[model samples]
Target: MRISRLAPEVATSRLIARTSGLLTVMGGLGAIALVLGSAGAMHPGAAALGPVTAGVGLVVMRWGHRIPLSGYRFLMAAGVVDIGVFAYASPTVGAAVAMLSLSAFAAMGSFLFFALPCALGYLAELLVMGAVVVVARGDVDAGVAGVLAVLVVGCAGAMAVVAHRAATAHEDALTGLVNRRGFDEALEAAVRATARTGEPLSAALFDLDHFKAVNDSRGHAAGDEMLRAVAATWTPLLPGTAVLARHGGDEFALLLPGSDGGSALACAEALRAALPHIGTSVGVAELAPGDSPADLMRRADAALYRVKSRGRGRSELDAGGQSPMARDLAAALAAGTSGGLSVHLQPVVTPADGEIVGVEALVRWTHPELGAVPPADFVPVAEREGLIGALGAFVWLAACRDARTLSEATGRSLFLTVNVSGLELDDPGFPDRVLATLAGSGWPAERTVVEVTESLVEAESTRSVHALHVLREHGLRVAIDDFGTGYSALSRLDTLPTDFLKLDNSFVSAITTSTRRARLLRSVMALADALDLILIAEGVETPEQARALASLGCPLAQGYLYGRPRPVAELVASLTAADVVDPPAVALASG
Candidate 1:
């Protein structure tokens, strides 16, 4: 197998071992040459010691992949043995210099193993180097030898620090698992291996169910402990060939080589069973012909979405076939008409006064036989089956009609935010279609916000940009939804035709639990302020989170704390009631 196919840690160990082995062999050959050239003065025992140690070191290096961590320790011990042989057989300045250089190299290699061992190894090397300098004073100037020894040890220490930093950059600070960058590299390697060998390659994406509840209820510290526990429990259970990485907050991805869907599913199930208390949902997809890394991950994510929708604490495998449920969803989308789809509104309120400032339009689906199908399950199907345009039209018309009614009932202006898919944006007639919808409902274009996700905005397509500018020119507002969750280039905010930035729920969830996250939220708020964009924080589930957002100078927030998504009539009733009460008391009454 290629060294790149090995696990990162094992690969690193193998590289260090091979390098040290080669150096040992070179030192041995040099020692033998010295003995032959010096004739009567140099001892033959020292010459034999080099070649013998070199052979053993090479053998250890050959097996380095199997004994990853231990191989480095053996090499370090071997270096010490080589130094002892040199000091005893050839007690001269040249031998002293050779042993000291070998000791420095060994010290540098120790860092590839671990931190504590590296520190101890460096100290031991320093002591040995000092003794060599003192013992060889008769052959060389003591002052000069001491100064060279200091320089060599210092250079070795610098090399160790550099190596440690490089390794740490690829490691997750939270769980000590491979981070996203490392995961991408490992995934690319797996893809290459599969292409070469025709071996089955599978990937699984897992999300911890209700992990936010743990962070919100117990504390962030407890949540961190839970994540650590998960990593520790699952790492040993995985096959050595499998690569596990922390994809991000509350999510993990696994790369399994030489495994088909069945094996991957079994592994995911075993992981779920092992962590029953911390419920997890997993999605597995085996590599298809001519698939890239992104294609594999997307399919796995779609499968994960299936598990999350059906229920958490389960594993589902994608075998490149349509499931019966997906077929039903596709059928339902095809039959979607006015009655088949409905709009639900969740209020976004001012944190200080708790007055409803806006409402986010969420689409829900219910079928005769399928019961209440969640939007997560069917939205992708709709998008994939070319029904999103029809679905989007329905949502926009319904939301505008309801928003006009709500505003009339409450006797106040209320802006309505509706989600627009990337597919709709790419449509040449999207802007004209939106205007027609608003005109049909007699809702002012100025009061409607078309929310697009960060990913779409990052696409920066000419068509999308032109469509957005057209919508803006018509007095409609554009929002970058789920900000900070994707490839968010904050600098682009200045150039993109956007009016609002909705900070994603992931950051909001951790705001109260992590000081660093809290600071980050403040920084994001500051950026929005500089861009002159209205900021709305999503997923504000607690009064504490609301207060935190307010303290950070965020004016608007939305989540279950204000109200869960409900029918338009219920939202109108709540809005009417809030209008009658003192605005400051509205929050308490709603709670």
Candidate 2:
């Protein structure tokens, strides 16, 4: 397939810059105030000290834009110092002493931004105030000073929490990178800045390959660890001027200020090569003068899809910022590309006797323009855009229609299990639609099974759960697909009316080597047996894996070892060649 390049928005750099500026101005002001007030120059003179400190605050805030992080720390220090000086400048002797103490407290609170300097400032201010009182012979109220100091500290503490929350809100909690939301805001600012300065900026999107299978096989916690490891690997390799963030899940976005497509591509290449086992697909696009964030993101995603189409572990530069595949798919859809999407089936056999009991229906898209776009390439985009429901229904109808024709021919009942997406649950008319489709096609509902996953279950709403129960009530079989991968595995098993548990390949992978995995697989098999649920092992890619699973008493198995998924016609031929008798056609749902 001819894949198009991605053009992500240049937004993250502007945001990082803005945040650095704010922190610098605030930090510097606190630091300067603490130093001046401690020297006794900014002390009792409200007249001279007030304007001088305010001027210093303004300068620090302004300089922050030029040297963000350094300026932020400097201003923050100044702000803390000025707070203390403002406290000591009170009219009465007792109030001045109290204000000095308040200054010390404020300095202590500023430690959130500048720990060592602020701490030293706090002690120095207290000592200076004590010395002033001793030398001047003025009445000093240590009690009032102590009370005011504590109050200032409390206020500073509250402000610190607010600042921290604001920072965290823009960051991806999982990887400490700027999140998509933060990236968007930054991109806009960068666009404006670039327009004014006439400098180029670039954005890139990276996606991990086979991430879902990894999550399903290893647990979400391990997946999270993998994500963090990837982030850690890439973060330091980025140029100091770059802004990077974990956009969400297995995706990440990088914004580079003053960088062109070539530079961005180089950086992406470096990051692509850093990971150990997993590969990454990077889509990058430099900002064109007036492009919108949405347009850039689309370009980047398209480019990413292009990279993925060619197979991952490569960086693709999108100078034109066009996702040809996505654009082609869109055009095809508009031009009635209904024929482009169709189901392919793979056989699942009883491991005990190598007898075919059923086939799993998978969808394929052969775009008229893009040509044979991989399912992984387009499926996520479909799901994200809510097109999966329509696609799912189409596949269901076709699979059921095929099953109905096959069932009546053989006299032996053949079961067809269709993959159900998370979207189907909330599909208001989903259950009724399935039932109606079955009735229209004269297909038996009992012969069809809807395979859903625990991840999909998490995506379901309460209404979807009700809809699922309704489907179950109508005599349709429901199997929890990819069992043991989701966080809510045990809970879903205990609650949802599931008839089969499809073990993810990760457990099967270890069964051949590790005793622990073998033991765990045994327990899972035992649990399924105890529950009287059918067990199907997924991803039995090798004969060895298939044999090991069968030895563990897993009745059903599916993977490339038996036969890879192919078009319906091809799948049927393979099954016939394997000597499985075709069942007589039996009517089932339309989809």
Candidate 3:
């Protein structure tokens, strides 16, 4: 109920300031109108009230950006006084009635800017103010007062509903923590406070590691409890000056005032240590000179991606100078079209024949300063920095280029496979973009296969799954990658619109030594066979593993044994022994 407790939201502050300025103009115009009329002849007292109303308007106009949210109460009180004088400033009943109706702005502002209790308290003040104007002014009738009451109460009631929805919008229902909307507001307020006080401000983003597996394995109910448990565990550990918010799914955001990089890192470590069982990856960043909230968060996110790529369950702090080379890698990828970002093709082949049936397009980024930034590193950066779409687009473009070159050199079109994140599917225009890329590259959809992780299919997201269906309808084949590594709902397997299933390396790596894993792989292969789906075994490093796979009837496979992912030049060199290397971006394996 106490708005003072809520973060001094920037949007809320701006709304109040703008509305106050508008109210001042409204009151000032009414006062000027009365001054231009015959108020001096009718009600001599009304002539004096004109100047009184104008004075209030001048005071209201002065309460601008400099005024803090705490001063909002004073603003509402001043508006009440201004309205009363404005009604009496005019001698005519119609003019007085119009001025009285404008009082609803005050009531509406109260609800829009404060909690229900605070707004209701202001409404009561308005009711009393109206009654006083009716009793004190004999010229103004009770009917005018009644109309004013209806207008104010009606508008205030409507705003109350709106405010309630807004309150909920700022909170996460499951965790009872502030949502992304609230986190952003808190961050802005903290930034402003830091600017004024010259105090340290730090922010961190927390991503729960491997959280999807929990959702798929234990059900959504268990996943929800994990989220709530995280909130409950972390809230008590936070300082009173700190704000923690849920950033959707298993991710969270935190803001800490008076904490620099070192302290923020320490705080993040403590929180991570306190977790029950889940591992978390944290990215911490402190406010830098001339840095906005977004800049600070972006740096933190970059640091976060680095931590995730290395391995989760650790905290990485982005000191102002941290990873400057990879800070905006996605943008660099965009600019590095000729040299920085490229597609490396890894061959997917039939195990028995050792023939390269197709090439899997893997992205590689070479930062000018940080040359050869691995896909694992830059891929997360693209996703975190909102450059994933561009990255995906670039991969398609590069793959098309290589596919054309290889087809010319080898004399046939090989089915090309490219990896896509589930996040890409959320885009409504994803299919269009894919089609456009293929059409532009002159690559046939029939020869292109987009590989998505099994975890993506397992999630059962309507948008993502539907996007897969759309891709299939457009003649693009879909392959579920990292197959034994997900929370596989076997029942849903038959229903999935897929052309191939790629066995995960985790199971493949142990398949030769572990009989159980080998049996499991066989079962998956048979399952794929029953569904008329082609099965591809991945990560075949040893000759024995290759023999084992072939013996067990693996239709297709790829790995280091087939010669590692290499560039087009390397592929050409492998076939014929002339030492050659690509300028950038090519990695393909042999069958």
Candidate 4:
């Protein structure tokens, strides 16, 4: 609560209060020892003080949290009085030298709890008090002074080593800013602290816009220098309440307690102006009501992505509530994954035998007031409102968990396909998150497939492509969804990592009547064969379309003809033991 630059290192008030309690008890015990050794030279009042001090210590220890600022000043003041009493009353140089041990505890307490300056001042007070006592003894105990000096200097040195290790462990060596671990701790603390005070807490993420280019062109050393320079330039300009950390390579995180979104943006602009050389993309978001630290960071990070997508070298604040519906939907997802939001399952079938091979997980939200909100309406709201990542994560977790149940409930093994947004795909961590969901839900990675829109794959953002590759590398399959709808060069198919291609519904809807469309479907089947990719025909609504797909030797397809999207429970319940569903769509698929 000191609001110093080393606020992170400050000892909590409870810790200081408890330390004070312990020291007071020790001081009382020492008084008892002096009385016992003095052979009736000490007064009875001094004897009575021992029990009183010990009792007070117990109270202080028990009620430490109630003390102001957790008792930093209280402990410091107590240490001063304690040393003064010991120094003023020491009868001999030997006694004075022995009293320096008490100084060591106080020194360690001060140095460990307070910042460098305050810790050093406390250490100096102890030494000066001990020196005065040593001189007042009227006997040259140069040895005692030497011992006192060692005790003080040694405590300070030990503290220095400890402080260095603590800083290095949490500090980024390159930029001398807080590391990810430190930032996480501070952010969590700020969230709790702001919640208690009802003060605003804003979080922001910063990334060097062209950092990769700088690293590639100028070498890593220059990149390191640039990062260091940026840190150095901005470090002093930041307020004590603000914490700046290196979130990861070329990225930074900042926490500003007591600042709202607007104030955070102003501070961000100042930081942007400070960075003379390279441009940055920054996202800022304030702590919304009922927000956890993770939620705040996601909103900020999402805004950062939005900035990069629009055009970099700018800052964007997740100005919460892009619309009333968006706000309500975001809250619904946060309230509980199962409360109003759920993942529905639509079968992806094998056309030749009309057997269900897998299911595509579709996210559906049934609002409490609005009934079933269409994905078409809500998904855009999620993207625009920076809730897509949260929405995507929820779907992945819920779908994977449900997919396991789908397999268990039906006595069938099925692969799970979950669609991803372009914004989600663009994130480098998206694949790892998906892998986490599978692992956490006890689902096999080999049986999982990630569906990305064909339009997204066609654009070919390097980050998005890399994310898909990462997924495939971990035994997860990638599918180019709604194929033939997006403008992708056929040549790209050779290099793009893919395992399945679902024909766009438009292509399937017309394939029954249009010879040209049927011929194109045949060509697509051949292309799938050449690429070793499976083809799933989408929107097989009629028996004629199903037979046409089977005639063309298309391996798999999914649509209302197979089954409409349903809850995993209902979908599994409607299926027979052989994985055949009792539906007209299933009959239609059987040819």
Q: Report each candidate's C-alpha RMSD, comma-separated, in the order given.
A: 16.8, 14.2, 7.0, 6.2
Across residues 140-238, which tens digit of lDDT does each residue of candidate 2 receive?
555654565465556556645554565567778888788888888878777777888999888998888768768778999999999889888888888
Q: Highest lDDT: which candidate?
A: 4
In TM-score terms, which candidate is top? Answer: 4
lDDT (CA) for every model shown?
A: 0.75, 0.66, 0.75, 0.78
Pairs with backbone N, CA or C atoms under 3 Å apart (clashes), candidate 3: 344-586, 344-587, 345-587, 345-588, 346-588, 347-589, 565-588, 566-587, 566-588, 567-586
The candidate with the higher lDDT, 2 or 3, is 3
lDDT for 425 in candidate 1 is 81
lDDT of 4 at 531: 76
**TM-score for each candidate, following the candidate numbering:** 0.47, 0.47, 0.71, 0.74
Please tell me which model should have the higher lDDT, number 1 or number 2.
Answer: 1
Question: Which residue pairs collide in model 1, if any?
Answer: none
lDDT of 3 by residue, 1-591 (tens): 124222233135555666666665666666667557644443556555556655655555565656775676886787687677767655677776776777787887787777657778889988888777777767777766787789989998887777677667788899999988888877887898889999999999898887877987999999999999999999999998888999767888999999999999999999999995889999998899888897788778767756765556799988574244445564566576665777777877667756676788887776677678777777655665545677787788889878877766765447899899755775567999999989988988888888988766654444566788898888888888888765654667776778888888887789889999889888988788788788888898988888888889898888888867778777755654532222221122111
Give the alpha carbon lDDT tens digit for every residue of 135-246 in model 4.
7765736876787789777986797668656646788888888899989988988888887899989989998886766876899999999999889888898998899999
Model 1: residues >4 Å from true position, as ranges?
A: 1-14, 21-95, 113-160, 192-199, 210-226, 232-242, 257-259, 273-279, 309-313, 321-591
Clashes of 1: 0
Query: Taking the tens digit of each residue's C-alpha lDDT, what string does model 1 give over 1-591?
Result: 322222234345457557666666766666665565553465666667767876766776686556555545555676666765674466566665555555555555554445655556655765674575456455655675676567667766686667667766778999998898888888888898799999999999988987766887899999999999999999999999888999877889999999998999999999989997888989899888878887687678667655665555789887564456655655655665433667898888888756787889999888767778798887777554345677788789888988888778877667889998776785668999999999989999988888998877654444567899999899888888999986644757877888888989999999999999999988888887777788889999999998888888787889999999988898777766665642431221110
Greater TM-score among 3 and 4 belongs to 4
